[model samples]
Target: MEPVLLALKFLVPLAYLATTAIYGRLFFAPEESRFARKATLGLAISLILHIALLLCLGYSLQRCPLGTIGEGLLFLAWILAVIHLLSEWLADTRRLGLFTLLPTTLCVVVGVFLLRPDFALPPQLQSSFLVFHIVASLASYACFSMASILAGLYLVLHAKLKHKNFDITFRKLPPLDKLDKLSANWSFLGSATMVVASVIGWVWVRKDGLAGMNFKELAIYLVLAVFLGAGISRRLFGWRGRRHAIAILIGFLLMLLTNMIGTHGFQN
Candidate 1:
């Protein structure tokens, strides 16, 4: 079991790197080129392997493998890959793969190398509500990450359009309007999921009689507040285009900081 787990730990990242390479080639090649098909196939295979790895880890540990930060990172990467693939298929855009896979690859690398392996499940996490809360939170994070990538791309393309700089890359990217809409959709989904997760977390806290807010809890609430403000600003102030995109980027950064503080701040 240990040998198989080790092998999967190595194979998963290699598969992602290969997918990244394929997508990189697709970025340079035409949209209808064979590389696009290969990139999709590569991503499918990588996602399958990643899911299998998670399943095997859960089987070996005799519980959900998301008990540790390392395992959570692995799950986070898996969710990101799944979301990216679905968005690409729905939008029929291959160019975004380059932007999306970069961060997924980074997550896998960090999970495998930087995080310590821990399989011991905490007592509080054994509950179904708690498990779903964490899953929803992580899934929401994945959506926000994707939205951030789309927002970043939107800013780049918007700037290119403003400067009348029409390069091959610019031509390959989705239209600014499409990018903006996609980013907004992702942000909406993320915020909705976060709200549901927050409700579940509150219920769990009340049931368990946990103490006052911890650093992680405070950070999460702050992220939720940011999302709420962004939503309100967009609807009431008519903040669209670059303004909306910048809001998404800021929200994603805050989410990242929340994750960092959650993972490291409470360790001591």
Candidate 2:
């Protein structure tokens, strides 16, 4: 089972890479082309395989698969891919594939090749509440990641429009307004999830008598606050387009910074 799990871990990323190639064809193909359908189908299959791999890992370890940094990275990549597929289904947009899949593939590559998997599940994460909190937080991070990618695309389109560079790529991207709304929607979802995760984390910490107001916790809250502020500004001040995009980009940077400082269970 261990050997099978390891092989699946390697295979999952290759599947994702194949999906990326199929999606890349969408750049030249029509919106409703056969390639778009194939790409969507490929993503669905890849997601299923990824989930199965995680389940096998969990079963083999007799614990949650998210006990190690490498496992967490794989889980995060899975969440991103799932969320992207959901978004694609809801919006019927294939263009977001490249942006989303690029990071997804990178995450899988890093998880499989760069990070070492620790089979030991820490005592601190034995609680179900902590597990839920961590899962929710990772999901929120995935949402924020999608928002940042959309925001980046928004800025690129905005620049092209500003300079009147009506090239093929410019025409290929989603409309500025659509991208803005999508970014905002993802940000709102991420913020809401972050709030829930934070509350759960606080409660768990208090119940366990652990110090909850650490630097990493503070950083996570700060990032959540930025997302909330961005959403509020969008609603109250009617901030959109470039400014809103920049705010989301900044929030994503803060998220990366928080990850760099330390994640939940791994923090000092």
Candidate 3:
């Protein structure tokens, strides 16, 4: 098991790195989409290896692999990878791979460096409820991260069109409307997932007789508030395009800050 885990730790990141390279090639020279199928296969295999690695790590620790900040990074990479693959298939767009997979690959590589497979969970955090909360929270974070990437692309493409600079990159990008729609869809999903995760966390706290949330936990609520506010502005004020995209970007930053704080607390 140790040998398998060690091999997987190295292989998982390498697979993601290789797949990201393939996607980078496809992004620049989309005419070479003959390689897209092969890239997708590689990404699928990477995702499988990622899951297996998580399982092995969890089994080795005798707890959920989600007990530390580094483990959260691993989980987030897997969630984002899954989201990217599904979005590509559903939206039928392959050009966004470079933007998405670069960060996903980074997460896996950084996670490998930081992962402590021997870390033990405190008895207080050993509940089934905590597992669900962590899963949903990570899912929400991934969705927000994806939405931010799409929003950034939308702004870039919008600028290129405004300046009348229709380069090969512009031609390769998904249409403005598609980017807008995908960003909105991901933001909505992130908001919904955050709501569910928050409710579960609240219930768990109450069940455990905790009086209130800590500063790190409140940071999560800040994230939820940002997304909720963005959603409300969109529905009520008909916000879209640059305005909504900017809002999503802000939420993404907040999510990152929140994760860092949480991770710091865990390490302490």
Candidate 4:
């Protein structure tokens, strides 16, 4: 059973990748069609496979999978996939599936590279706070990163419109106004979630009697500062354009660094 589940862990990602590619082509080919529908279905299948893998892991050895870097990545990927689908279900989301599912595919590929071809839960990584923290924070990061990239692309297009340069990619993207609103909304949600995740992790650490400020903690603080500061600038001073995009990208990268430090320094 574990073997079969492990095989599924491999097969599921491959299927999602194929779906993403096929649907991406159909999406951008002649006319914008039901790419979202196809990606959503693919994402749904991947979630089920992740659940099956979790069940197999629990059956063999009850573990939380929080202690390993490899498990952490795929778990984060699954969480982001869920967030992506839910966000679409709740609101108007278009053409972001490519970004979301591509990263997910890359994450699973990393998992495959680190695969041991078996399931055994880690003994030292059992914390509900950590689980929720990773899930919420990574999902937040996923959405923010997706939105930030789109914003940057929009800025590129805007620049082209100003008689600077013209390109094919910029010609096909959504309108600048649409990108602006979506980026603002996504950033707002992600910033809130990240703040919550950071607070939760701090509470858990303090409760566990391990209240030392680590690199990851510092990184989180810095990211929060940048994101919130940019938000303030956007509101108060009417800051926009490249500054907004840069701040978003900077915060996104710092969030990635924070996760890396968290996984490497504490878990590893």
* 2 or 3, greater by TM-score: 3
What C-alpha lDDT does candidate 3 achieve relative to the native structure?
0.87
Which of candidates 2 and 3 is the stronger one according to lDDT?
3
Clashing pairs in 3: none
lDDT of 2: 0.85
Q: For residues 101-204, could you state the per-residue lDDT of candidate 2 as single tens digits? A: 98998888787664444566566777788678879988999999999999999999999999999986687898899999999999999999999998898888
Cα lDDT, all candidates: 0.83, 0.85, 0.87, 0.69
How close is every model to the real structure, measured as TM-score?
Answer: 0.93, 0.94, 0.95, 0.83
Q: After superposition, how far is residue 68 of candidate 3 from its true place, in Å?
A: 1.0
Clashes of each: 0, 0, 0, 0
Per-residue lDDT over 151-207 for candidate 1, one digit per residue giving the tens place of the 0 to 100 score:
999999999999999897788889999998898888888989999888887887777
Error in Å for residue 264 of model 4: 7.2
**Per TM-score, what order, best first?**
3, 2, 1, 4
Give lDDT: candidate 2, residue 66.
72
Residue ranges of candidate 4 with Cα displaced over 4 Å: 34-37, 115-124, 163-168, 261-268
Positional deviation of residue 251's Cα in model 1 after best superposition, in angstroms: 0.9
> Global CA lDDT of candidate 1, please?
0.83
